[model samples]
Every structure is written in structure tokens, then in C-alpha cells.
Target: MGQRVAYYRRRRGYSQAVLSGLVGRSEEWLSQIERGARDIDRLSTILEVAKALRIVPQRLLPGPFHTTPRQTQQSGTIGTAPDVVPDIETAMLRYDGIAGLVGITDPGPVNLGHLERQVELSFVCSQTEQWSRMAPLVPGMIADSYHASRQAVTDAEKRRAKTLEALVYRVTSGMLDRLGEPRLPWVAAERSMAAAEMTEDPLLIAGGAWRLAVVLRHSGRLTESTDVPTAAADALRRDDRNATPEHLSVYGSLMLKGAVGAASVNDHSAVRDYLSEVERTAERLGSDRNDFWFAFGPTNVSIHRVWLALELGDPSQAIDLADAVPLDQLPPELAERRVSHLITVAWAYYLRRRYREALDALTEARMAAPEQLIFTGRVHTMLSGMLRRERRSIKHDLRELSEFVGVAG
Candidate 1:
């Protein structure tokens, strides 16, 4: 509110260039941040800055988080809990503008919150009576979520950021595999500008950038994503501060980027090496029990590795890693990861014509997240398609299928 943030940074004897490098931003970006041209994204960044300048969040928060949420609590559902946004789904339906997310100002980075809304709305829109209407907005919605996240800088804001980030990853890397489109991760990369400027913590800033790299890789921008992680890693090395779980999670994400890239290029050599690197990253960050953010440990990265193997058509490798997953231990926030992955495994079996096995996996997945995060429409949307593909593909047993998808045979 009062240029107090800049005041503190300056009093600490750090110039824009000095802090920007530490946070993986350019001095120019920092200049803009001080001038209010940019938005802050990561809470860790905010916290870091507070410490660096011997201040706390209250100093820069012109107005701190709302004493109450913008919206009142809608009753949650039984399985996945609350289901009140029946119309929130419609707002997504109504948001038909396809101009695409411009991301934040200055560099126009991809916005994490924008992408997340994309995933949620897309999944919902995938069920649209005219699915096409919902299609174009997916990318832009994702972009806007990232924009919202770019300026996010508190536990409250991080909740919003990670929620959006997770949704985008689920839809693109997890659920919506049929639509072959390149996801733009410009938001994730640029959004970290806020993360860095607000926090003054290299690890925090790099973590935001690392998320962008993984998103980029997931979106098929392998080369750019491949090259990005090192920026963050380099920053982390330079900062040489004590490792926080959030920081390690950022590093873990970079390792995932390598794994995703190697798999995308079909380079098993690179893939294995990156997989090892991810494990090492997770191990190194093992002591970080910070709960919600960046809690994606070795198992989390391992899950991605299996997906990468699946993408590479190595089911044996997939099964091997799948066997070792401890789905129960993950944070509640990662419930969707388990949800979508279960669907993938079952669908994989179905693709292989292993009907019974496929049905079994479907049952397990249904048990994992029964309420359909938002669009139960898709599960049923495809059942008819599956039956049409082979009326008898599931010739013998339909009970599991019916129960799993909640459809009557």
C-alpha cells in the first residue's frame, strides 16, 4: 500500500538487480513490481521478503486477506464434499470468450489460477450439450487462473494458486488427453515474477518457475521447459539458504520436468536419469513436512514417472511403478491426482481389451473419489461410446462397470 515493500528491500542494502537475481527475475521486473506494474504470486516469496527487510506481511499488505471469504460456504457433498456451485459450473459455461489468457502485464506470463479454472471449467464444459462452446475457453481460463495466482502471496493466496495449478495439471497432463493442443505455460514462468518480487526468496521464486517448466513440458513445449528449471536451480544454489520443503518441492518439480521431457522425446536414457534426479530431489527435500504446498515427495514424482512411462507405451514400467504407489499417504489436496490416475489406469486396461482388469481398476478408482470432482458427465459421456465401440467388449461382466460409472446396464 505504501511502497513500504521497496523501502524495506532498499534499507536491507539490496538493489533491484541484487534481489531479482536471487529471486530469478530481471532488475527491470523488480522495478515494475516496486512501481505496482506487477503482481505477487507465491506466499513463500512474500514471507521471504518480509524476513529480508526485517518486516512482516502486514507491512506490504495494503489490505490483508479478507476476514471472511468472498463467498459464503456452500454445503459440501458427501464424498468429495460440497457441491453448491451448481451455477459456478454455468459461469464457466457462460465464459465463452476465447481470446486466450494474456497472463500478467510486462511479459504476459501464464497465470496458474487461470489454468486451474480452465481444468475445472473444461471438465465441466466437456459435458456441455454443445461441447464445442466450452472447448475454446479452456486455455484462456487456465491462463486467467495463473494470472490470479501470479499476484497471490499469502497462505490464502497460495491455496488459490495451488488449487488452480493442480486443476490445470489434472486436465491437461491427467484427464483431457484426447484434445491435442499445446498448453501455454507463459503464465507460470512469468507469474514467478510476483513470487520473486514479493518473497525475495530465490527458492520460492524458482519453485514458481519450476511449476511453469513442468506445465510447459506437459503442454508439449519440451525444449523451453527443459531449459527453464536450471534458472531456478541456479538461483537456489546462489541463495544457499536453509532448504525449506517449499524450496525442495520446487526442485522436485524441475526433476519432474526432466522426466516429462525425456519421456516426451522418447529418450529412455534421459527419462531414467531424470527419474533418478527427481528421486534424489525428493530425498533431498525429504524433511520438508510443510503439508499443503510442494509436498509432492518422491511418490508424487514417481506417479508422474509412471504416467510418463504410460505415455511412452511402456505399460510394464507403468505397472512396476504403479505397484509401489502409496496413494493413501498423499495430502488431501492431492485427492484429484489419485482420482485421475485411477481413471487412466483403468482406461489403459480397457484400451488393451483386458475387460475384467479394466473393470477392476475402474471400481478402485470410483471408490477413490466417487463424487466426480465436478463433471460426472464425462464418465457417463464415454460409457455409451465404449459400448458402441464394442457392444460386447465388456461382453460378460457389466456389474462392475455399471457400479463404477453409476450407469445402469
Candidate 2:
């Protein structure tokens, strides 16, 4: 561990003093860390060091030390390896049809109806926050969809197959992102865009762009995230035929993504413009609706406003907006969305030093989606920090949360 730290530090052109200062440690302490004389054992310190070095925590750790555990067959237990992530990566990268062509495997007959149903189930599982059920389904979905696209005979069949494949990849990317597997999600997003382009449907293409833009935003490519979706939304607007609710939902969702990306970079002006566009679309739609699983509607728009306020450092505004947004009113299919909003609300409370409210919100989120909550890196980090700073009055409750989220108190 020390040697790896030393290597990355030097590679990043950061001297011992600079690196030590960055992590709030002394030069000698950093040297000891780099020379095997001392150990950096705490998860928070490891995270700090990794952040200063601009690398993942896994890179600094010796073995498979993912901060978030992937779901295993067992309902509540955490696993060490996060095996499902690697399996999904292998399945997506292998493109199993090649093995079938080489006589190593059999690519079965294409079944568009079955594939479509499976895709729908995956989306439902994701939205409902069933990580255990949804994750195990992804590898088979990816491999089977790829094989189906290959075996498709007619042009129409091929397009249908490709659309299913793209949707599968898009959902897979989102799941992987939530699982804290950084690189594989980008691969899935790229595959989604590539598959969508082959179908020549602008709506499908825009959906792909939306997925890619979201992944980019999470990956910290804020400029490209905002620009890509903005361009796609503009193209959709120029064509009068693309103004259907389905297309408009996707367009509005893209604008939401742009708003998030803009807020992340502190571009308040861009955020307002993008949000105005989203509001216009939401007003046209009349009420909350989930078209194309984009979940673009007035309630969804309000949720984004809370997130945007939080991102822009206005915790008071975020909390106020969150209070008005009735997450319980959201349909069962939007469970993930609801829990995610709860997390943002918790963050707002945390920022305002209202630890009890933050803990209550997180507790509510855990009750709704324990597996998903445990796998969120931001939640883990926040809980860890809370454990460090929480008052003695709330120490027991905060510690319980720390344990639940797999963070050391």
C-alpha cells in the first residue's frame, strides 16, 4: 500500500510535503506511509489519499476493496469480491455472438417479444430498487440481446433487436454506476449509443444520448455531459414530428440532465435555462408520468429542483423544496427516484448541521431500499463523516447508520 501511494504521488508530480498537506497530514507521516513504516488503515484516510491522487480507492488498496459491495445471492449480507460487476463486464466485453460464429457456442434463435419483456422487467427492477434481482439479470440480458441482434434476419427485426440491446445496455449502465463500478458503466453507455445509432431512430438516438450524458456527468465530464444532451434536445425540437409526448419526455429528461451537469459545475445561468425548458415540457405533459422510463413530469421536475439547489450549495432552498415534494405520492415504479431524492434531502440536512434530520432521512431511505443505500459511495462517505463529527447525543443512532452503510465509525 505504501509503495503504491509513493508511486502514484510521484506519478502525479506531488512531493511528499504537497501530498501530505493535501491530505491534512505531515510530510514525515506521508513518507512513512510511502515507505512501509506506517499503515493507512482508515477508509476515510484512504479515500482522502485516493482523492488527492485523483485515483479510485481500489487503486490504492491492495486487493478487491470496493467501497460499495455488489449484491450477492444472499438477501442482506455483503460480499467481498463484488463478483457480479466483473461478470457483467465480462459478458458485455465478450460479445458472445463471436464465439457462436467460431463454433465455440450456440447463439439461439432470436425472440424479440421475450427480449422486450426481459428489458421491461430489468427497468422495473431498477426503478423498484431491487438490486439483488436486477443485477443477476444483466449479464444474461446483454449476451442474449447481442446474440439476438446478430441472428435477426429482416431489417425490421434487426432494428427491433438493436433497440432492445440499446435499452438493455442503458439500464445496465445505470445499475453499474449505482454499484460504484466506474469504468464498466462507461463501456455500457458507449455500447448503448452505438447500438442506438445503428437503428436510425432519432428518439432512440436521443435516449442513448441522454444515457451517455448522465454517465458523463457522473464521471465528472460536466461540459460534455451538458453539451451532448443539449445538442440532442435541440435537434429533437427542430423537427415538428418529434413533439409527441414520448419524444418530449425524452427531450425534457435530457434537459434535466443538462441542468444537473450545469449545476455540478456551478453554472447557475445554464441551470436556469435548462430547467426552464424542462418546466415548459412538464407543463405540456400536465402531470407526473413515466414515458420511456424517463419519469419526466411536474413531480420529477420538483425533485430536480431540490437536487439542483443542493448542488449549488443552497441547502436551505433544497430542504424547503424537498419538504414540498411528496415522495410518497410517487408511484411504486419510481421507488429508486424517491429514495434518491431522500438522499439529497439528507445531504441538505447534513450541510445545515441538522444531524438528526439527516439521520432520519437516511433511515427512511434505508427502509425503502437498503441494498441500494449500502451501495451508494456518496452515502457511505457522508455517513462516515457524520460518524466522525456527530454529537454524543446522536452518536448511537449515527453509529447504527454507519454500520448499516458499511462505514467504520
Candidate 3:
């Protein structure tokens, strides 16, 4: 305990009295922490002190020392390692803290450190929160995969290792783009391309490129993003079967991206056309046997369906689809997914001038996933539209939402 406190304190160059003062504790209490006399299980207090020290809260927690951590479960299978789950669980908590910070849930460096710690802790675990916890680290994962390619001990190892990296990149990028941060997705794209090149895997490359394109489109570079999915679909079309798990995921993700992008621009025709492609892609992906990673199961399919419905100006359908998510098999994973889905539902309501309902849905979204301001834009758009439509105003609530996201209404 003493060692942990002293370690972070020195790393941040904070004196004992300074940290004590920051946390509103006595230097004597802080001394007890550094001398191993304190239990340190009182993480809230320790975290408070660590925040004052401007160090990641994780730096103060016991690491994998006492626990015999487990290796990752084999691919395409459920991983039931208890020790590994702790780090994963801790990462989720961290991600929640950071997301709250990003949404202006708290406006202090302490909260900022919480977000960084979440990202850092995620790397220490094989699986973080399925979406929010893992998405932010896509760029670094690509970089690591690149390094691993060079370290491949055998030819078979090379393909397997690099392919795994590409898959990670796609999963993270897919989720990130939907979560409203295209810039980070682009970084994942570059990494995906490099990994694909090293392994000579076109599907992997297309997946990454597709994600980058989606990012570009969402970032207001619609034409450029449109090209990505077009090229990826073209690349897949040339292959033996455009239905491989890799190809299916890439195709499905791109289709979803395009659908959402077109909807954003109020292009109903394009949205309908893309929605057709989405159904076809889902059908094709159904034949793939992989369950753990790229399952693209009913729950996942429903998630996207809700998003598409929201985009097509159908709030009721979106809510119905989102509510169909089966949470029994994967609660944590569903927690994040459910949060994202609710945001779309809220937006659909917001679009229809249903302020109270939209607010209700948005509140649920925040409760489900505190890592991102999932409904920020849609809420603002709805509020503005309502103001004009009814000649009534809800700027007070808009300001509240904006403050949470560290933005202005």
C-alpha cells in the first residue's frame, strides 16, 4: 500500500503534504497510506488522493500480483477466466468514469485521469467492455499488431496473429464510428491497412478501409466515405465467397455506416437502398459459425436495425428493435450496446417533437453507458427543431445536456 502511494506520488512529483491537502486529508493519514499501514481497500479515498496526485487511479490499486491471471480463451469461444474478468471489469468502470468526464459529468483533471486509466487498464485485459471499453484503444492495438507481425515465430503464427489484430481493429472501429468519434476510427483504419498488407489479407484490409471511409463520411467527407464501402464491396465481390466471417463483418459494418451516413443527410432513398444491403449482408453473415468474436448475432443485428430505423424517421420501430436485445448471455456487453441503442431511440423521439420521451430515453442511455454522450447531438437537433415547430423553447434542458458533454447549447 505504502509502495503504491509513494510510487504514484513520486511519478507525479507530489509531496506528501500537497496530496493530503488536495484530498482534504491530513498528512498523517497520507503517511499511513505510504507506510503499508492502511488497508487501501477503501479505494474511494485512495482514488481521491491519487486524483490529487494527478496519477492514474489504477496506479494505486493492486495489480496482478496476488492473482494468478488467466490467458485469453481460445478464439470463437467464451472466455470464463475469473482473474482476467477483474481487469476487464475494472476497465469498464474506468471507461464509465472517463465517459462521464467527456460528457462533462465532471469537469476536472481527476475525471480526465479516470478516462486515461480506463484505456490503459483495457490493454491489461483480453476483453474490456465489449464496446466503449475496447473501442478507444483501436489505434494502439493496430500498432501492437504491427509489432507482433515482425515478431511472428512461424508462418502460420504470422497469419493467425495478424488476422486477430485486423479483427480487433474492425470491431473497435465499427463501434467507435457509431459512438460518434470518426477521427479515432480513421487511425484504426491505417493500422488495419498495414496489418492486412503484412498478412496479405484483402478482407481484413477492406474492413479497416471500410471503417475509415465511414469515419470520413461521418466527419462530413461523405463522398470519400462512400468510396470506401464501394471499394470494399468490390474487393469482396472478387473473392471466392463474399460470405466469409471477415468479409461479412466488413461488408455489414460498411453497409451500416453508409445507411447511417445517408440518413444523417436526410436521404431516405439512399437509406432504404442501404437498408436492403444491410439485410442481405446479415443473411450472408448468418452462415458463419464463429460465435465469440464476429458472431453478428440476432442481438447485434437488432442493434443496427434500431439505428437504421432511427435514421429512417421511425422512432417506434427503433425502440421496438432496441428493446429486443437479449441481455441474458452477455449483460456487460449488452449494457454498452443497450446504451447506444437507446440514444438512437431518444433521437427518433427528439425528431418527432416528443421532448419528455426523448429526455426519458436519453436518461436511460446515460445510465446504460456513461462513457460517451450518446444522445448529445440528436437531443440538440430535436430541441432546435421543436423550438421552431411549436414556438416553445427547451433551451434550459439543452444547456444541461451540453454541460454534461462539455459543450455549449
Best by lDDT: 2
Candidate 1 stretches greater than 4 Å from native:
1-189, 192-198, 238-241, 287-292, 331-333, 370-385, 391-409
Better of 1 and 2 by TM-score: 2
Report RMSD (Å) for each prediction in the order shown. Answer: 20.5, 5.6, 18.8
- Estimate the overall C-alpha local distance difference test score of candidate 1: 0.52
**Residue 288, candidate 3: alpha-carbon lDDT:** 28
Error of 3 at 293 (Å): 5.1
Query: lDDT of all predictions, in order shown?
Result: 0.52, 0.80, 0.54
Which candidate has the top score in TM-score? 2
CA displacement after TM-score superposition, residue 7 of candidate 3 (Å): 47
Shift in Å, residue 271, candidate 2: 0.8
lDDT of 1 by residue, 41-116 (tens): 2233554556556665546543211111111122122311112122323333332232245222423655554465
Candidate 1 is scored at a TM of 0.50
Per-residue CA lDDT of model 3 for 98-156, tens digit only, reads: 54464423222222233334434443222222333353454444334434444567888
What's the distance in Å from true for residue 278, model 1? 1.9
lDDT of 2: 0.80
lDDT of 2 by residue, 1-409 (tens): 7889999999999999999999999999998777655555344467678889999766874432254554444355443325577888778767743565555464668667887888999899778677666777788888788788878889998999999989999999888877767588788898999999999999889989998997776665667988999899898889746478887788899889889888876789989998998999989877788877888888899999999998887889999998788776688778888889999888888767788898899988877777667777667646865775768888888887787677886
